[model samples]
Target: MIGTLDKAKLKERYDICIVGSGPSGMTLAAELAYSGLKIAMIESGSFKRSSLAEELKEVQSEKLPIKANSRERVVGGASSTWGGLSALLDPADLAHWPLSFDELLPYLKAAAKYHFPSLETFQNPSGTGWKFKNLADKLFVAVRPPFNFTSLVNIFNRKGVDLYTEATVAKLVSQNGRIKKVLCRSVDGQGFEVSAEIFILACGGIENSRLLLVSGLGNEYDQVGRYFMNHPKGYAGRLHLSKPLPVNNYYLPRVVGGRMVYAGLRLEEELQKEKGLLNACVQFEPDLGIFQKYAFAIWRRMPGFSTKVLTIFLPRTLRARWFADMEPRAENRVILSDKLDRFGSPLPKVVYDLSERDKATLEELFSQLRSGVERLELGKLTGTAADVLKVVKDDASHHLGGTRMGLSPQESVVNTECRVHSSENLYVVGGSVFPSAGCASPTMTMVALSIRLAEHVKSKLASKPRRTFKNQTSRTSSQKILIIGAGNRVRGDVLPVLESLPGFEITGIFARHASSLFGAHRSYDVRTMESLSVENLKGARFLYVSVPRETLAQVLSDLPGASSLEVIIDTPVLPAVKKYAHKFKRIHVAEDSVFLPWLDGLKGREVKEIECSQSVFRYHGMALVKAFGPINYGYRLGNKLYLKAGNTKVKIIEPRDYASGKLKIDGQEPDLTAIIAELIPEERGLLGEIKSTDTIVSKMGELKRVGLRRLLLAASRGEETWSLEEGLNDVRIDWLLHKVWIYLSI
Candidate 1:
């Protein structure tokens, strides 16, 4: 079960212990969840970012300006914030790697299935329509809406994997050429030990090296953190087209088959090999003038404006941006710093820069790009080789090569299976194990390798009998709740609340898009929802419906077959679902806005005159005012509202006009948090009145009565008092506000 270190009971030992909760670690865990092995997944950060996680990220950089957003320590790791544009590594880039491209192809397809919406995204469109001799299309597909692994944390625990967040691994204890255990500390500074038969370090590029260097585990010849590399990228020059070329459209990121696909221009593989140049991809941004810029912005804002009409007046010139792979150099490495973090582990001192060959490659690639443009009679590039060299300096934040994998111990930290050469049980994954940084983004490749590692791990441990363990109970013995959708709303808001709250358990998840769940929610019994089964509905006490409004009727139509199940509809009840609504014994419309913490001061206050602007009347504003006190008269029409109750004049302001949870009432403003706070106990009691005999709902009502007391007691004892459901509800409101904006704009 997934829990904070201070909460979940620790097992004495586990079959496998993975350090880190990024795409790599989560992928590996999801793949191995059905292996019947007791696993402990330790994450340095919680589901949310904390001060301790931020403090632990400090490092000494030589040439690279390591931005704060470069890496994330949260549960989902970098995937939490990444744009999700990725591609498989080229065969040439993996020339020196122990694993061949052919060997990795299967895992690559598997990884694509897990991360990408469809495999056709990998079958990139041929750019024969946009003819060019020297340049070929370098396709990069973005995981639209960017999938986060946070939703899978609970799923992992449910599958017998104990996931501990906010547990930072401090040091690895080794004996007889194998890792014995990992000494870890909670964010609250409590120390604990996790001993496992196999230990995998998936802590990204820099931290993986730093951990190895400080622990003295895998650096046999001081090669643990060497060969550090990042993709060097920046603007090369400007290309002035004779006329608008169709090839320019390929340069921009566009939606293709429900995915963001960017067909960047790159030097042909044959040409790159002939010139001995590094792999590079170039993007083109139209260089619009001042007036053109405003016109373009306005055109984007107005949906009815035709892009063809706007494009006629735009500039023919475009800024050429280039990203090139760097050669892995020993001089550009991660070494231990003299200073230590709060945990007493030495900080990482990163010394990295481009070599002379790297600079030459950029210059050559730019020259080739100019030649190709000239050959195609498309454009004229205005820049010298020196200009390209001078501007190609920014880091693409694709960290790679440190703790690189190879067959030799003297040359690398890990072997072909990513096992540490110095220790059999210890292994390293993620971008850190890459022997070379490919031109493409590293996330997809990292996931593929993680899946491959899981395969190897499973094969090695298959013959070993399952280890007996105590406290085999899952995270919670609460009421089972079956989720109906796995869309943005469910994943971003609903799942977090259910996972964090005390009296809920996610029994199963149903969604049409279960194919992409290979990364996180795979541990659950995920299936495409065609029709609700009576057997499945009987297992869950409550069915949470979180689909789009348009499809609400079709989804709820199947729900009437399972009459015993209580339904909680997060979406607004449309006219179509009203027929099926009466069929249910107990139905609850979860009006989340009424429980907004900002209105707590007005909880018992009598309301008189209520005026809502056209913007705020549709969502939360009306419900919020109604929740405050009795409203004698009110009329709402097309976003405008007027109401009378007592004497106070209350006006509901548009959400965008103020900060989060801020409301303007009688010229006074108030801010708030925890939308779930006020809703609880009252909401719980209401449910309890219906099902007093039901043990699960009764226990939840009991918990609600003492939630504040338990929160205070936990705080006094230096325990975690994070109001996660409150925060997630706030996020849900934000998502709703976003939808409102889209609606108004359209």
Candidate 2:
């Protein structure tokens, strides 16, 4: 379909000219192309020659990522090489933006349809789980949250949008505050020039801003390249699950027809308070053995001169990368150089920088992570012990706001609607309009805004005197799936249902479609309830739900008239006591479990030694605290403490209790999770001290150092009680190691 020719051919004017073929650009094109808008899309890469090698290179002839992110500079843009995970920008991610979250929710659903196509994905993830079901034994700690984004770009093609790969935009030819024409060309020096009533910028967060700076537009505020963002992802390091796998390590697929297939455990928040900053996300990959076998097979099928067996080596190590986000400082920006590319456009010059704030966030996130690893008993102290943390070689590349949108011209490059402040009709679209860097990925939000902008543009077009009909949003979906549990407008449960309902062949998005009265969070009146009935529970292949509720009697009384269906839920509450407990065909949950994937240090346990006079374990005999009625004594241990939940032998001690033998095993209780919570007190706690299975198997030195440092920092900084028990001991790294090694070796 790429028939246009002539390197310098100039078409006076047309409809729209969209640059870049990534999700933002492609989705925008889809919204406008079918309108019979004479669209001219310019891409820098050719569709026929797209390859993984070329896409991963990080630079094109030394040009950095078209602007900085790892956006695919191919025909389909980043979407061409994306992993296809499509989570909407969480409300938390958009919290700092000028627009209200409610404004974007509806659009997000529409965008979800294009990004995540599987009907199973459209329902609750707990319902349509992993592609492969049998490998779950080894991957014991995977929890796919409610909005685990997946790829579904094929849906865009079906909607009749035009695509141009390997082409690039050279410049925008504007007049009278409007984009009258676009100057574009291919990497091979071929050129194109066209015009449209509306122009969109969806190249990506990084590139969109670069394009603006390169085109020399909207520079009054010097904001064209500021506010750069990306979802900084980090990891807690290698996780070793409690269960045995077929091999040492392997990847598991989600259960057949289930929403949650992949699981990941984050450092509990309580621990993060102690750690400095590290917003981390770790992903598992196909196993090394499986990869090796696949490679050998590929070699057997297409052997090379080198035997090609070594290429089978795959990475199973859990990687930690820093999404401890970076803000776009004016100094950290994309500038234009005097040199132009073969296409006659000035190449973009980018300077990437990390502010102290950026580093601190990561430092804290990782700090808690270190403590967490100890508690989970996942891996040995290898990756994290080092000073500098290593990020995943491969990570989520969805770009975000570069030409950020803001309330005033001084703070942002684009106005609230993505329009260049002073220039009417000269609008910028895509992730580049975000005000703050989000912790979540940005594609779904890009699509959401695109649809909204498209409608605005359509309405503007329809308003013309000659226009015959107005384009209405089409919500007529054809697929159907069953929904369940905790969602809807009432009781403030709107988000989960809203995110899952819009796209599926939705038979209904409810707890039990057979009867909404039972377990219905949005039933306005309780007086209109019905008796619980299992007869209407048939025909559902998938189900979506929220955190499990303890009160089921109310639901049982108002049961609907449908049969059972597959189900997905947002919480980890297991199903033991239930009317349909035996019907656990393939249940899915949102968060990671505590036991499996054993990376959480507390997953197992570690013991620590303290100088406190009150003995934690003199011979594992006397109750230390009870024996010494009152003494100024306390020792530190990891969260995976030797004591069981509520084990009486364990005693907790604080500085205030220096004279009393009293110590709270937990802040006031016990439990592996609880201890970890008290030690780190972060998003997910890291430090865990414990009484052990054998003679105090301890990582003593590490504990003393972390504990000391934590205590000092907390006390000197602002801890209420000047005691060592409340935190990590931050001593010289080597010193900490020496102490632990000496004790353990002895």
Candidate 3:
């Protein structure tokens, strides 16, 4: 009764309560704000100028990332301060999205019309080739996503949109599983209630999940607050052209139907298949520093830097990075945190880690891109693949998941219409409804879906007077079961797998560097034999071992505890490891041999080999813990490698990149003093026990008695099933042989 009549002043109830004032939310609000059906649009942040002024204040104070880049609170949500990179999601992502492209085509076009009246002005891109006779101009630059729809919400708000700024929803009022009202709070500590026939959760991905978790309706799938994903994006390698290109790569057009100006890259599906890594989609990013410098340079040379010629001439000579989209599996996800926010609502604690397959896919993707540019006459490539290293995995405060929409209630959180299955009148309108964060940006696609949803809702609102259509006492949108997974790809195989996921939780990717003979060193090798732990397989539902055939068991014997399924994508040897086939989900038949010769070269290369332990990486004397949560698990400390050469005779080192430590031997360090453990002592690690107990068993007599090598291997396996007794039976065999036969043969 309190929630029902809380709107004492208003006798009439609204048809919808639209949350958020960002691109998607604003369009929905603008479309129905003046439809005369009674609508209550809410905004978490106020649009007042005071907030906008505060933005530049941080420009000099560390120049933190933008709101869309990091911060979330401000007027108009993130849209108020976006770069206007309204790049429509790639066709591949749209095709793979939960909602169909055909279904969203009209709505997308409508959204463009509704929000962007001046949209045609920036339709096409035009620019001229750059002349790089100078050192700065010689760098090769490419295209990236754009920022055009900047003042978007303001455009709609000026058109009679009922505005409610600084309004935060505390809880959703429910009656018989349907939302009856929204409990809202003002910045001034005042409270209000909005009664609506429909409710849309448009508070961005993170906030949307926060609302769900806060409202106490998220315990069902364990999938609710899981699979929090992001592109794990970063500025990677560049195309340092031998000669500069025609135009600058960062020019965004100001006016219509411009050539869809974007630098492009392709996923090498052929190679990725051998690794069991799914290729979602791939993209290219232009150098921002180059863009900034060039623009400023023009402004300095010619004070009036706003000339059309300047725009046309500077986009060519710059560096670019290519991005590959990854697969959507159950392991990558969002989970809830016990931490509360200013509003007392729990903040969404995101736990997203990547799998070995994701890293392998990324490594393969970059190699293909590099090879395409160098050998295939694509372009002149610059920088070692290692130069393109950094990855930002903890974001998507832009993308999120958990409440995935699938064909069945058992698999998804919502139905086809972006409605939660367990609740009524509630529809997720922001990127939160997106099951997967494909390689592309999600705004355009989400906006298109909201528009379609709005019309569907409008049609169903005939009111009590027109009870014929309502004769059945139809349940709310929350009760409707939507067919989420049925969709078609506009560009199917040509696009990456990430492009194919929609309304599904594909989370972004797990990234790592690929080992190269003339390039960068590797992190781990699963060939001959490899050891790892269960905890190390965190956030993983899929495992693809790319090692030598003979060593398949050496690597996979301990992996069963990490994931229910294991796939052997490629191996160095064959037939030997093939015998253990019955234990794995599938085996990738190797028709190509890029990995074979590479295995032969492992003897000379320094790579980290890993195993499992209770502690992953130690920092400040604290051990990183791991356990299964909503959707994914955490990473464990697997054994890493350390070189025993040069002055560094026995200094411990991390295996993959072979990053040396401060404890270098350099003559001062003792020989044979280095030791690497995959697990913590007491938890199965041989070195762990030594390190923890202050007991160093270095004598040969002690080694024989304790079965040191085998015991260490078992610790690396990190699963009780392997029994601390026999984890390294395979590893010790190689030791007996003194040198491996296959190692010499290759």
TM for every model, in the order presented, reads 0.73, 0.50, 0.51
Q: Mark the regions of model 2 whose C-alpha exceeds 4 Å error after superposition.
A: 5-12, 34-38, 50-69, 115-124, 127-167, 186-191, 231-236, 241-260, 263-279, 283-323, 373-382, 385-396, 465-746
Point out the higher-scoring one by lDDT: 1 or 3. Answer: 1
Error of 1 at 155 (Å): 2.1
Expressed as tens digits, the lDDT of each residue in 239-298 for candidate 3 is 655543443442232222222333244343444344655443334333456465575344
Q: Give the range of the ten consecutive residues with the poorest summed lDDT in model 3.
A: 620-629
CA shift of 704, model 3, Å: 91
What is the C-alpha lDDT profile of model 1 across 227-301, one tens digit per residue? 998887777678898986554364554555445565677667787788786677777766655654575355334
* Each prediction's whole-model lDDT (CA): 0.67, 0.43, 0.42
Instruction: Please give, for residues 126-215, the per-residue lDDT of candidate 2 as tens digits.
Output: 422122211111112111222211121221221123345455666777787777776766445656666677777766666677677767
| Model 3 spans with C-alpha error above 4 angstroms | 1-12, 49-71, 90-96, 114-161, 247-260, 268-317, 322-326, 376-380, 392-397, 463-746
Predicted structure 3, TM vs. truth: 0.51
